[model samples]
Target: MPAEKPSHFGASARRLVGRLAPYRMYIAISVALTIGGVVLSTLGPKILGRATDYVFAGLIGRNLPAGATVEEVVAGLRAQGKDTFADLVAGTPYLVPGQGIDFDALARVIMQVLALYLVAALLMWISVRLVNRISMWTVRDLRSDAEDQVHRLPLSYFDKQPRGEVLSRVTNDLDNVQQVLQQTFGQLLSAAVTVVAILAMMLWISPVLTIIAVLTIPVSVLVTVLIASRSQKLFKAQWAHTGTLNGQVEEAFTGHELVRVFGRREQVTARMREVNEELFDVTWRAQFISGVIMPAMFFIGNLGYVLVAVVGGLRVATGTLSLGSVQAFIQYSRQFTQPVTQVASMANQLQSGVASAERVFELLDEEPQVPDPVDTPPVSASRGRVEFEDVTFSYGPEPLIEDLSLVAEPGQTVAIVGPTGAGKTTLVNLIMRFYELDAGRITLDGRDITSMTRHDLRERIGMVLQDAWTFEGSIRDNIAYGRPGATDAEVHAAAQAAYVDRFVQHLPGGYDTVLDDEGSTVSVGEKQLITIARAFISQPSLLILDEATSSVDTRTELLVQEAMARLRTDRTSFVIAHRLSTIRDADLILVMEQGRIVEQGTHTGLLAAGGAYARLHAAQFRGAAVQVDAEKQAGEVPGAPG
Candidate 1:
């Protein structure tokens, strides 16, 4: 298979950010709270540094001579050739030389720092809660949009896509996005603000020291960029493999019965293992590569920290900076490195979110089906007069149906019979407008189908397909699926008409028994009867039975045919017949071959004319012909069981 489309990092990131537009007010509040909290928190170290200075000055002041001037203290230290110590002492807020530390002043600064931090913590806590709320609401809307998008997509989109992969993209990928936004959004914003605020504080104290603290930033960025580039591709591949693995597992389970009958259990298992291993490999690589970012950032940050400490201490001793300022600068250096480290770590997680975002955006960006016309031309009253005028259609390059024209008059039972792949089902599909005609028009009661809304067109038709699909529901609910607002009495009547009442009476709950999603509790024939009842209750103007009676036993088939015959009395009907005998009594028998109708007439008349219909009839009844002849000699009924 071709490689999954590579996600453009910048573009996907922009789109991800765009999802926050509707929640901008909440996001703004969160951001304001985060900035305020970060600002106050960054101020704590500077204020605490003043407390350090006061304590240090008090310890030394008591040892000095009493009533000493600031210059006297410096001069005395210089006289003893203690120039650096003198400079540090001179730089301090000079207390009277004999006085002890100012306990009251230190206490005041400490309380201020505590108050700032407590308020900062409160703000941050509240912001985090708000951010989480916004994240949930955003994801909820995103999931809703994805669900709506799936419905609007054309049927051809599903024909090419796997059900499981699409489900994974909508479900699994979306969950990943939600997690990333919830966990990372608030923290990232706080870290970013902390970095900026701390950096500014550092610069305010000493630009030289700030430069030294930030020297290793270029290396940290390089590490993140290099690892993230490789990790992104791996992350994308990991998600793609996850979707593929899910598809493989779903396929295996749905087809498990066939696989067991064909003895291909080992084959299916091997295929699953292959996809699982691929998923495992890509996930491991993605995690391992992204994991390298944090350690690399920490090493770079530690190097910057050491350089800042050495320079800061020297500046204090040289009297270019106050003791408190150096202490505060050292705190700022540590604070700065922390935010940088956090940001680097979150970069990897952001890449994962971006990959998932790409998947969702791909879904959202799918071309929807051509929109229904706003100004729908009103259709005539339902007479079920459907006509295809030189209809041409193709699934791919080659036309599947070319110049096909047919007319089903009101209340006529049209039976379409053909070999496999002869476009037997395609004819009905066209009438239902599943695929657009390539070069023709289909009309209902003289109005072009395109002129009317597809909903209105399909409302007049009811179909009973070969597969009797039933969802998890009561039998009554399953029958009522054809017409949701149908009364219980109508459901029962239709059930009785289709002979469903016969078997349902034996079921424990009758119409109310809950079936599994696959309807596996009921036998195949019973499921068919329920579906026929469903279509029967719909009371449509047009009916389509696509091999609708193929699953039942002969006796049940006859019963269903009888019921269908009654239902078909006053409606235009299209029956795609495989067992030639069932449609022998239809009003018109159409034989299709290679996208063209080769023959058309009544069953008896066509058989007598000896054309394609005769050949099909002969092929089906040759055994019966032989049996009858043998029975004539043996003096027994031909079809009687021995």
Candidate 2:
């Protein structure tokens, strides 16, 4: 069964954070640097406060006699009918009466503050660099794991999943994760530390002002929580639509010719537009909703800042707090609100990352194909003898291939011929173990196949699917893919055997010619021949060819028939026969319908018996490809796939 979609936030976030564990040393160093930077910067406001004290003290001191005490200056001014000014002088601390600004002290404090800020900036820069390393390593592993998971997944997993969606998860989602980490990780940690440090400093300056400043926190928390909850779902939906949009694009590109041939261009365009519209709407709404967090926090922080300022000014006038203290508190107020707003703003990015994270997690969490065995029995040379003992399997609830038994002796060619949905193509799948059996077992050379490793079992077999697949590489490279590091002589021999050499001789580069992934440079029939060449190079003990020559013309097909005759010598083969000629050459022909073999015999014997095989044989045109639906009606194997 396909895995369920994972929910976003907490669990996914935790899982993503857990990825950082391997680099804990680096993260710890980064965290230490961030805290050091914030702590150092926090002291700047307080240090500048001392300079404010000096400047204010000198201004008050200059108004009195040069050596007079603050009390004497206040009394003398009181006696001179200047009571209000006297009280101001009395209330201000560190007042050296009748003295001017302390130039030396001011310079010292200013330089100290400058030095602290410079160091803080340097630390922050280092912290950001460290964060980049952590994120790079983490995202690298994530991509590698996703790729490995894709390889290990069963074909059934892909049958239920769109290739485009899987591609989006591995590409787009992981990229988003990287961005989020780079943008937010260090900053979030720094902002949190700043908030805490500022609160402490504000309390030290005035407990009353600290109380007023913190009163806004509950409101900020409320706004963040409310907006985060709403926008999280929007972000999740946004990525979901992104995957859907990608799937549509992949499908359109994959079937570009088919769409034009069928005149469904407008239909595909309309579907894409619909998904695009949904993606746009959700992304806009998500950004809008999360955008509210920063503004709301700013508003609340401003109210708190204003209140603290008003209260601190009164306290300074009343002599309960120094003017420098009030100034420092004001600086703290600005610093505090900025970090809070930043934290709130980062909430949106965090939500998007979490959404992407869970999408990645869901892929990782999917049950992989049954794990490979810890140990597989070793085998001598395989002679291509295969047996199916009461094998039962199905795609869904209903059983298919139930209690089925069959055997192919060494060096025999078995041809499977049946109508559409008669399980003709399944013979190859069973032999290859693409789909596991539900009951009984299959064996290669009398060793239970499951006991042998999948690699060991598959290594002895060669296959050519109905669809011809090619990669972007030279013709020689494509053929060599079947057997890595094949000698030039070996490659030439295989290509000649598959009739690929004849076509290659005329091309501009011959065997050295490079083809695109789609192999658009060559004709479709030529592409099939290359694939046939690839299979031949594998040199497997057993061969499974599913309409391997279906795309070629009569001339090429006949040439391939001769090549196949030579290739089939002294080897077991399974041919999903689409033409009468292929069936006639088989040592045995299987007539299956609904996953059960209806008849089994040689061509002459089956024709003489006049059973299901005869009907299918009668349906196929002599020495030509069978008509699709007509073959099905006459039970002559209709489609390429099971």
Candidate 3:
């Protein structure tokens, strides 16, 4: 299947952020702490420069030659009537003029710098903690919402898309969203805050140097935008190919036996290789294009750094800027460019995350199945009287069933026999309300089925399909699935009635034997019997058996037929069978052709009329007809009680 188009990036981003509304307090705190950390970090270079300035001033004020003593410098300052300045210098420990430094004063400045760094580190830790909490909480809610959405969607939706494609959205796409939130979101926020703080400090130091550094912004942005524009589409393609690849692997592995039986292993492998090659092609292009962003931004940043150094040095040499200020400006220029580069890299990651979010939101936004009416009544006392009047339905543009009508009264078995695509299963689906009719209505127990809640209506009916399904649990659990609260004795009795106990008793654990997924641990016939036992435990007022005994052996089929006779004794039943012998005694036989009932009567009545049903019967039981003829010639009757 082709990939679905992604949703608008702006809309997906807004919806993703809106998911953080519940944790807005944490988000606010994280923002504040990030600002505080960036501010403190930005002040470090200037404070260190101030300390350097103090040492410079001490040397110049003393007028010290290379090896002059602190006493001589003090004497010189006192002679100039600078007593306060002289005393302030004398108070410094280890204040030898040119031979030694002011160790005491320098230690105090170092301690202040260390204090700022410590506080900044603490703030960063707290901010990251908060962001992580918020991101994890939001992703958890997204996973839960996606899973619940799957259940609410109509069956038709699953019929249209591969199961693995939906699974990829729920698991793989959500994982991408989580990775971006945890890593990229925090980095992006810190980068933005750092950029603003660094630029402000740079301007304060020297507007000339600030302009030199600011010139790089537009160039870097243009490069990043150009590269990202091309990369975004590749990123979208990468994820789409990923979904397709996952679907291929799932399909191949699930049907491995079929592939081997049909000698199509080479074909399956070739198909998988084709999908894998497509995935590799898109993945490398996305990586290569987005990969250009970092290096391009770095080149622009280096250009700005060289310009700042040259301009600031000239101003310092001309006596317009102090050495300490020049030093601080250099540090600020580097800080300013670092965030720009970080932001550029983060932009690529953010685009990929947005692509994943688009897939997830597509599923979340699918229209759910139409709900029952608000004032719908509860199902009345059900006597299993089902009526379909002038019903019509279609799975596509062309209608499959038109003006179809049927009635199954209480305690009657309606056997539906037809060729393939005769709308037999479609009719059952309409009766159970699995698919809504295009027009007309179906009634159960004299009440319009549409007027009653679907849950209430389906609860009173039990279905056993041709392909039986069992979950990964003990055999006992599979049998008791329809009624979870069924007693162990009830489970055993139902199993015995369906003849499942015949094989189950021979297993090592008896009823407690575990079945793997798909119930492949047991034979197909055994699986069908287990489903029959499940329906028996439900004790439904209405029953549907669609080729329920087709997989069983002759002896087992006879046992199941006896059980069916007892099961339909006092309840309404709809039986769809290809074999004409199974439903010979049905109270009403419906022969369908091209989605319409061409004949309706007892089996003998239909055969005597020689209509569609009679032709089907002859086609299926040609040998039986010849045997009846031979028995009649031998003076023996066929179909007589032994």
On TM-score, the candidate that comes out on top is: 2
Cα deviation in Å at residue 471, candidate 3?
1.7
lDDT of each residue in 359-477, candidate 2, tens digit only: 99889888788777776657789999989899888878998677888899999999987767777777679788887888899989998887777888899999988789899999999
Judging by lDDT against the true structure, name the best candidate: 1
What is the lDDT of every predicted structure here? 0.88, 0.87, 0.85
Candidate 2 clash pair list: 61-98, 61-99, 418-637
Clashing pairs in 1: none
- Report the C-alpha lDDT of model 1 over 206-317, residue by residue, as the tens digit: 9999889888888888888999998999888888898898889889899989999999999999999999999999999999999999999989888888888888888888
Clashes of each: 0, 3, 0
TM-score of 3: 0.88
Give the Cα error of residue 528 in candidate 2, in Å.
1.8
TM-score against native, each model: 0.93, 0.94, 0.88
Q: Encode model 3's per-residue lDDT on 217-263: one tens digit a residue.
A: 99999998899888888888888788888888899998999999999
The TM-score obtained by model 1 is 0.93
